[model samples]
Target: MTDHADLLELAVEVAREAAALVTERRRAGVEVADTKTSPTDVVTEVDHAAEELIRDRLLAARPDDGIVGEEGDDTPSTSGVTWVVDPIDGTVNFLYGIPQYAISIAAKEGDEVVAGVVLDVTKGEAFTATRGGGAHLDGRPVRVRDVVPLEHRLVITGFSYQRETRVKQAAAIARLLGRVRDVRRLGSAALDLCYVACGRADAYVEEGLNEWDLAAGGLVVEEAGGRWAQRPGVGGKRLVLASPAGGFDDFVAAVEGCGFTAS
Candidate 1:
């Protein structure tokens, strides 16, 4: 039988190790390794190094499992399981010396994510979850916050690297701003999802997040009693929208009303 909790343990371990490596490298300073999609969408040497380290450690522990990562080519699955990883989820923040970046890792059995972890590098906090198991932060059980009114809920979001897409997002956000208590652009999707999971924020939404970016943190949100959904947004990129259960429907209506789903 596939042990989801066991997979969670392995993911947490690998994520922590990667976090340590990332922190050490950040202290030495960062250099731009390349750009993807646009000049502002940056990747650093530390990102590559951290991903390599994570791949090595994970493969060493589970040789037959497939691996997919932000910075590395996909390894096909042979053991009916795969790992989706984002060695550094907020690379732009890392490059700029911000402390919000994280190492996110998740285990999937077939198409379903069975286990996951998101490690905050600078904060040393690990958010973890397993299918059928509740979510946790540093071993403490966590759940989304209780009822919050529409006008008082704090929402977090991120913009796409594409300029045209961002222009649309800006307009959507402007519409959303009046409906919520406030908004935050934290530059880290993984952390943003975890924040929603743990009640740090009432909700989150973003477009253009890849599988590696959503796998771990999405699982965390579901396990924390929150609801998340993705839909085709502007330019056909995914628009991930999530909120605590108490106000999820209200939140979705607000998002759609804000023109987030308009192509």
Candidate 2:
């Protein structure tokens, strides 16, 4: 538990630092803009600056750990401790002046995530989790809501950047929206899953996420007594679904109709 606690501390510190960098850059102004894959996928000066800030802090503290970042190259780690980062989880939101984005960081031992942090820079809110120690929001313990019924369930989701995939993803959301109490596309997956962890959102699902995007928030959701899985009858890449333990079955049922890739 001590090591886990220490890891959480380190991740929290690194995330906060990254968040500060994001804040400073966002407030100062985003001068340089670049697009990836499509016009919708974006990277700005802040994302690169924030990732460098995170890499410096994390690698300096634990030099042996490998680091993988959304905005940077993968540096393979020999120590089996890999630190994954999404410097700006919602760059589109950030660039457009939306405050729903977050900074995500997680450390994995082998394939298992041992520590995680999601910092909502706009709100100065932080969520942290360790493998067995449970999840926390601003240093206080937090857990998922126990919402169960479809009529009462609130869900959050994200769409893919690929045009064809986005159309399919939209149709699935349309069906789900009519069945659920309500649905939202928050743009920031890290904050959305953190919301699920702390009972702010009942459940969340998304497709085509890289490790950096889901690592911290997924672990946080698990630590907060939520369950994680691929949509029923769907493979790992189809959709990553997560909900409170009490709402798991309903969530699975709601997403059962999604068009997903085969395992």
Candidate 3:
């Protein structure tokens, strides 16, 4: 039997180690390693270094498990388990010396994510979850906040690096602002989901999130007694959505009405 807790433990361990390396490197200064999708969509030397560190540690721990990382090529699994890694989600924030980036890691058996961790590089906060186990922050159990009314729900989101997508997202946000309590654009998707998981926010929705970006944090949100979903949206990208269960259906309706998912 695949032990989900075992996977979660390994993910948390590797993620913390990678976070340390990232923090150490950021202190030395940052250099742009490359860009993806758009010029503003950057990858840094620290990003590559951290990802390699994570991949190496994870593979050393579980030799037969596959790896899918933001900064490296995919490694197929013989053990039926794959690790999804985002070496530094919110790399732009990291480059700007903002304290919101994270090391995200998740383990999946087949297509189902079984375990996950999102370690905040700057805050030293660890958000973790397993398939049946509940979500936790710093080892204490956590849950999403009770239902907030539509006009008072604090919605969080991210914009695409591409200008066209950002333009559309802005339009959606403009429409959404009047209906919700407020909105925040926090560069990191992983942390945004975790924020909702721990009741720091009431909901999160974003389009164009890659699998590595969503895997660990999405699992955390689900395990926290919250709800999430994804569907085709503008540019054919997946419009990821999440909220406390009480507000999810209404939040989705609001998101759609505001053109968040309009093609």
Q: Which tens-of-lDDT digit does each residue in 1-263 have in candidate 3?
A: 67999998888888889999999999999999999999999999999999899999999989999999989999999999999999999999999999999999999999999999999999999999999899999999999999989999999999888898889889999999999999998899999999999999999999999999999999999999999999777756889999998889999999999998865
Give me the displacement of residue 204 in model 1, in angstroms.
Answer: 0.5
Cα error of candidate 3 at position 246, Å: 1.6
| TM-score of each model, in listed order | 0.98, 0.93, 0.98
Instruction: Summarize candidate 1's per-residue lDDT along 1-263 as a digit string, tens digits.
Output: 57998888888888888888998898898899999989999999999999999999989999999999999899998999999999999999998888899999999999999999999999999999999899999999999988689999999999999999999999999999998899999999999999999999999989999999999999999999999998888646999998997788889888888988864
How far out, in Å, is residue 23 in model 1?
0.8
Clashes of each: 0, 0, 0
Clashing pairs in 3: none
lDDT value for candidate 2? Answer: 0.84
lDDT of each: 0.92, 0.84, 0.93
Colliding residue pairs in candidate 1? none
After aligning candidate 1 to the native by TM-score, how far in Å is the CA of 62 from where it should be?
0.6
Cα RMSD for candidate 1? 0.9
